[model samples]
Target: MRKLIAISSGILLLALSLAWWMNSRQPQPVELMPILTGQPEYCVTCHSDLPEISASHPVETFGCVSCHGGERLALDADLAHSTMRGGANPSDLSVAEISCGGSSCHTGSEADDRDHIQRVMTSVQSTYAGAIANIRYTFGAQTDLTAHQGINAITDERTQTGITALEIFNPTLESNPMIQKFGEECFTCHINAVPREGESYTRQTGCAACHSTEQHQLTTAISYTQCNTCHNRGNYDLRTMTFVERTDHLTNRLEEYYQPIAQFTQCEYTLDCVDCHTRSEVMGDGDLHSNQKDIQYVQCKTCHGTLTELPLTKTLTDPNDIAFRMAFLKPVVDLKLGDTILVTEQGEPLWNTRVLPDGTYEMIGKATKQKFNFRPVMGTACEQKPNEQESHFCHECHAVER
Candidate 1:
């Protein structure tokens, strides 16, 4: 009995020592009390090496629990991550309303230009409506090219276009085998769809699809490479119902920017997609559309004037102007009140562009931050006709050899 008691005491002592050593190896709990929630969180204890997410979303303001819905107090890795909102992405549409929405955040009044979530939900990128419409039309599943279905059913209350709702498109329900094949194969490029499994097709779903980089950092300075993940990665072989990946080893920016068959000018490849495409064009105008052409109205004449007239100019007079808000988001150019800037045909302001004293326009690249001074074709020696001011027409004379 005495020997058994001694052995039991020795085992207990060894267990206690092991526990003490493990506890010592664990990191000290670093408490953070965020101003937004006024709640204390210990996430920094484990994630001490992570950099600040962005300038706007400060750790001191928005603690990890706010965006990444994990346990605030729990220190164990599993317990901390068990209740995470979207597993590594909080901006995912599945939980965006709870994680990133609110009147103060992304889902606010359209008049105030804060309805980002709603706009994205109704956007063609998220719906994949155009591709569906085309495939169904080609395969005789639908009569016209109008979109009647999307990946998921969605309704827009204040639709400017005739289409106010889109029914959920189910590939299994589709009768046409070609349409079914299209649904099965061509559903990977949408913002809501999980991208194809590869290095080239790597991208997150929902808002992060466009706003976040591979590092999972949110940014407004989106580059051409980010857009290429979906736009220029590969083309689909409709005959075989398979996506053929681009096997060409690109040597220049022009080749890297677009596919070989595409004809583009120097500026098209020189500037990033975000540099020319407006917020509404890329994100959506809070309405459902049949195709990209319906929303994308940025013509060549929008920046470069026609031979008959100069480009439309709007001077910033109102402090509450949308241009000011746009400039605040980008911050590449300082847009002061009373400064004249170019406007699109639809009256959207080119916030980064400004008219110089010499009548030339200066534009700062949204992603690259490079400055370019250009004069409109109004007084130039160019022979472009007034009526033929489309980008394709300009490409006739300006297309660079690929």
Candidate 2:
């Protein structure tokens, strides 16, 4: 009975102490966040603590209103995002003109820094009409493969190529059942195709296919994984010579598959697609190419270097080109070739390249800072064709005994 009484008193004391502490403390004041300067947006009030999207798209300079169209002064979520384009992704074709293009970002010639919108429209990847026409022709539904068989973008004449008529799958137009079925089932890979709900970022339509590296984020360093989302899908029906839809099968690394048009290359497992393919090739040459082969001009010899002559890299008179100067922050190997200057995508010349003692032409990636060594095949025991420079001929050294 004595111990129980003492325990009750202790509990009463503890409760009184907690009440006293609670009574002593006053309510803290809420510190209001400040709006961002320059652009005059209140988005920074919330997203100020958030990480910057990328080095290029600085929030302080670009602000929220530039790429993502939103009410700068509004505090409410719905009001701020009321007129936003492409939701979280402004680079989408539907709103890309006002977002990514305009007179500012990515709006000049493809050779220049501002031609993404111009180049991509005519790119083979953007236009699935060629592929659709070819398949229909092969299946005997169409007489030839020159017809435009997909929804076409209304672009300028310079940007537009081949046929510009907007087309979809039509059973009535195509007499052959296979051609009819082909249009209905397999017509959504083009740039115009809107993203289905809950699709992967890589499978997204339009600029998102390459630029939107993540689900909602964008980046310059795109990986090969995204390329596989579209390229690795489906298969060819050898007997019928028709492309048939197949399930997206993810297998172990050992059981790998590649596009049959390309030779079974060592680079298949070794390098990323972007490593070999240049910006002009993938982004496009500002031409409406019939196929991917027409645009992709980077040969094995380009990177590996010719067997005999060495490429030169020289200095320029002045830093006239602002874009190139920014891209070339530092030299890779710093191996100076002759006196000729090396130019980047902008056609502005680069400097500070050197040749290694091993006879390899060492150069830095224009903007990526990637180190490259172009080995001259002239001295090597390579059984290349007479002036032939295909990858299949170069990959003979790593040929498996199969």
Candidate 3:
């Protein structure tokens, strides 16, 4: 009886050990499902509006998940549905080599954030045009405008590079290579929403912010009409008018073709891809107007800040007060740094600091005269609601609104 009992106890212990081992060795599957509903679609629905990015390749119909890895159908805001984190993962781009730039899109060893956006846009467009031709002509005939433009009998024929309606496409023209505006770059003319000094927060704006376009008055967003933002009316003739009178920079010999100056010259200064050509000459071959033979042409401001464009502002000499009230007249202004402003006869102030949130200001003392009025040394003023008496709150007169 004792032997039988010992045998039974040993068998029971062995069974328990086997069960524990099996449980420990079992593998658990990782949860890669998305946490949010209508995820990839939600992002795609809006991103598709960007024609250069959405009109071609798998992205035309495929959702964000196709390029930017993530659960396309996620319903929650969890890590499982995350697309890119700490630069580890990014969208599966079509041309992986083109992802060298700084941006949230692709984080690679070769990526550069400085102008990644422009490079990406240009690459995507070039790739798409090539792909479309492959499908339509099967063997890359003169199907697209690029080919026609490239093969034009007159090397100086005009073509499109996207921004303005101007057909300033001339192969013979030299370009400012550093001013990547002619190619797929965005910031060459675009601006991001960022915070401003004295102002809590401000939306991103373009040249149109300060420069008003009679054509775009009804529109809320900035437009090219605001060209004087940089090229003021006074300097317009100097930049545009002067270019036309000079000998063709492409062909050293005087040419008959008129170089189109479509933009307001000041704000719309960057050249599109066609502006920088590999096979064109402007002025006679060996003159200052000729293109660089071996080196790529770049804007002086790009690598060298020799021609720094400082923001211009109107003088605000407070005859009564000693401090000067300088105001920047750009599209977006910041008051976070704190400034002193004087109320103008118009509802607008003489020196508009940065735009305030909620379309209102923290009026401390009387709007007119005070020790500390929320104003900046430099800024511009815009049209405001007109009233019989200027609007003022007691708090703005007494309390320091920072």
Candidate 4:
């Protein structure tokens, strides 16, 4: 009987060991999409209100795996969100300085770092005004113009050509006193913040916000021609079409009085503002304007000219296809260091230029095609100041006296 008891005990021990081995050999469960990065999943639980706005937090939409570049699963939020360390927290403090903007993907320009941070903070903290006019104007004015699509547009195709009608001149006016007068729900786009759901007819649209513009006063479908209706175009002392010049001296020396097309009856002349004015921003394919001293060197010969030649002058055209008579108006072109343009004299073409576009090319005198494909000629004629030779015109660069 003792011998039988010992055998039975040995059999029981063997069976228990086999069961434990089978359990240990089973496969572990697998996960599909892991939350492997910063506390994005945590941050989005609160900030998913507007995913479309680019200026707003964009990483939250990319999911956790795109940024974290590590293991997905963690036992708790502390382990999931904490930076990985080999052992205990290391002596290196560099990990503490890591930020959303500090990432290689979002580094703003050196000059714009502080401003970008302030703008981001303002977006996070302040309540937006729910005014429709303010909303439209803000989007219309502040949307990224480099994308070649204005805020008001649904699609943008002209980005490559560098031309678009959508203009967002100044973006920070939301902080102005006029914006504050309407109270918390000042702009409808910011309704996410205030959550007011009433359909009252009294709420003003895009008019009130634009009417308050101190410069480039926008009207609801207001024709560019009627600008002089409330403005004194010539005196330059009083308001010109709702734009009050801030300084005593005008920056654009080449600016003649702007004549809006809507007011013209039998005039047979219409000019787009771009034909005279340079875009404040620089670009590669399109014409640009400069506010500094007018010089032939900085004019239309900048971009169109090949490396070996200068550009020839061509007749200027208005938006309406009317050929501007040389006697009536001069064509202006921007000239940079390397461009190509046509230089013409008395209905004859002369040289093509090698510089890119920078300053305006306004017709000052009539010179027939004399020199064929001349390199930047010296001692050109002068319109305003004559004593200076015109090889590298514009005192901003050459510094020669007129």
Candidate 5:
């Protein structure tokens, strides 16, 4: 019995050693997993340990080479990186069509629901074309707003100025030093230009301007700090038409730098920029606008219940509203047919909500455990019968905690 046991132990040990040798002989992470579409990729053989970028993009399904155009089959680093579209960034507008976009992806076409590239191109934010036109016109260098006009090319054109309707201001060609200086100094924040090289957070431009957070994650629950990158930057002198660097560096409030130049009520400081700016207002609902004001024309009366009336309905039908939806898609949350009301994140009034045993009304955020309490504004202090309840008026008395 002892002899037999010894022989068995020796055989097990030899088998284990052979298995280890076989594993060691194989190339480290040489397995190329095929995705749902396109060719097999080997990029993950090296970047298998990279941090997750977002829930939207899964390395397992999309693979690195899908958005980032590189020689996927090449094992050598030089050959692999040879055809990289935008260095480490593929979402950059410069190469988005070939990188982040595809026929089924954000391919600059409205036929697909995921046409992000198409919408962003026409958006005022993407086409700083309007602002540049206005500035050049104001300087008397152009005959009209149409002179030196630049706009997004509706077709397959994809350059900095969106295929260029006409020649926008080129600092090298401009005879006026002021216009040249303005082009050099003031044009950094536009979504078209590539972000500054250093500072990863500051370097996230184009689609990343809003979707990418300070923590370097792609998310929708954005805050005021995200808006600070551009909105709360250096002061612009209205009197001299000059732009000056900010004195202080620490702050999330626009008032810290924009004070005296622009007025902000206490309400502006209390809530987030998204609180008032609806999805359409911020993201542009497939409709092109002239300027920032035209795009973000949200009024205070929209959210805060108006005088003598409530803006939102309080009735809903449950089981239809979900926990999660698309970036711009909101839940169906405003059903007037029933006794209870539920509001979707996108402000859509649909049939969804429930009734509690008690009289108080409540709602759960879509796909989240967070709850919202609904109150009628008809009897509240805001609904004075004969007076105007404008934003500036209420902000004077109801100040946010410092």
Candidate 6:
């Protein structure tokens, strides 16, 4: 009995020694106390391999806990992620206010152009008001083409279009079969909606839907491919109230850029969408618009002047001009004080464009970073009518065939 007890004690001693040696070989936990939060966090111990989120958001200052809520001191994987906001996507609208909101952040004064969250929430893309209005009117659910409902209920006290509020549109409650089918089958293209299951429709929700790439990094240099995920991947079949994916393979960039029925100019297919569309046009102007037409006002004449006058030019005199701020965010072009750039009819500056010393306008592509020199239609031998200056009229003469 004494010999057996001695052997058992030796075995237990060897096991304890082996356990201590294995633990010593492992890497130690790394703790970080961010300047913004001033709270100690152990997230880096597990996520040390992740790249910095962006130049605007530094890991050293923000740390992981500030943006991604979790057990800052937890070492176990499940415990650390148990309270995380939005799981893998913290910028989701459902929790974006908690994750990315403040007066200095995305939700702030509209005069400073910092009210991103409010603008996006009321944008036509989020509301889906236009499609709902059209379908409801066509199916006799409503009397006119005016929008009376949105995907979600929203209110805007300062709406310029007199559409102060919209009741939540529950298509399931409608009596029309077509309206009910629209609710069941045709409601996935909105910014908050989960994209259809496919590689072409791959995208995140809310702000990350447009700002984040597959590398888990945020960027402002968005490409046409990213927009294609939601816009050009497929078309909805109104007859059947279903979505039909594009099946025809294209042979060239122009063919791939737009649908076969589209008539676009060379620059339309060449430049990315962000190059032409202003921030207010795409992100909403803090107003509750009924349809896209009410929001989008950029025309061919916005960049290229009419035959009588050059495009509207505004010289950058203030150091705190919004154009400088926009250029700093994208960084594709260098804009300086006294440099004259084109402005939209609504007075939004085209920060990526500049008037050269030779009197020609030079535009830097927002995504491709390519330089393009263009002359206003005033000097060219173009016969565009003054009143008929819409882009579709220009396409009648300059549109490239698919």
Q: Give candidates' CA RMSD values in order.
A: 1.5, 8.8, 22.1, 21.3, 9.2, 1.8
TM-score of every candidate: 0.96, 0.70, 0.19, 0.21, 0.69, 0.95
Compose the digit string of candidate 6's lDDT tens values, residues 282-303.
Answer: 7788888878899999998999
lDDT of 4 at 2: 92
Which has the better lDDT: candidate 2, or candidate 4?
Answer: 2
lDDT by residue (tens digit), candidate 3, 136-251: 23233335433222111122212123311112223234243321222222111122111122221122232112222332121212222232222111211222222112323434
Candidate 2: count of backbone clashes, pairs at least 3 residues apart or interchain: 11
Which parts of model 4 have CA positions greater than 4 angstroms off? 1-151, 161-309, 313-376, 379-402
lDDT of 6: 0.88
lDDT by residue (tens digit), candidate 4, 237-288: 1112122222333233122223321222111122222222221111111221
Poorly placed runs, candidate 1 (over 4 Å): 1-4
Q: Which consecutive 10 residues in model 5 have the weakest lDDT in total?
A: 321-330
Clashes of each: 0, 11, 70, 57, 10, 0
Q: Rank the candidates by lDDT, best first.
A: 1, 6, 2, 5, 4, 3
Structure candidate 1, residue pairs in collision: none
- Taken over the whole model, the C-alpha lDDT of each candidate is 0.89, 0.58, 0.27, 0.28, 0.57, 0.88
Model 4, residue 123: C-alpha shift (Å): 29
Tens-place lDDT per residue, model 1, 1-402, is: 999999999999999999999999988999999999999999999898887877778899998888889899999999999999999898888888888889998899998989999998999998889888888888888899998999889998777998989999998888988888888788889997899998878888888898887564788888898898898888999998888889889787788899988889888998889887888899999999999999999977889889888899999999999999888878899999999999988788999999999999999999899998888988788898757878999999989885
lDDT of 5 by residue, 1-402 (tens): 999999999999999999999888755655555475557888777776677667667766777777777998887789999999777666677787787677766674553345777667666667665676666777767766642433334333443322334344466666766666666666666665654443422746667777667433566555666666666666545345466655665455545424444546554665566544655556555654445665564544444455564445444344343222342243324333345543433564322234445533454343232455555445566634346565555555554534
Task: Tell me model 5's lDDT, rounded to 2 decimals.
Answer: 0.57
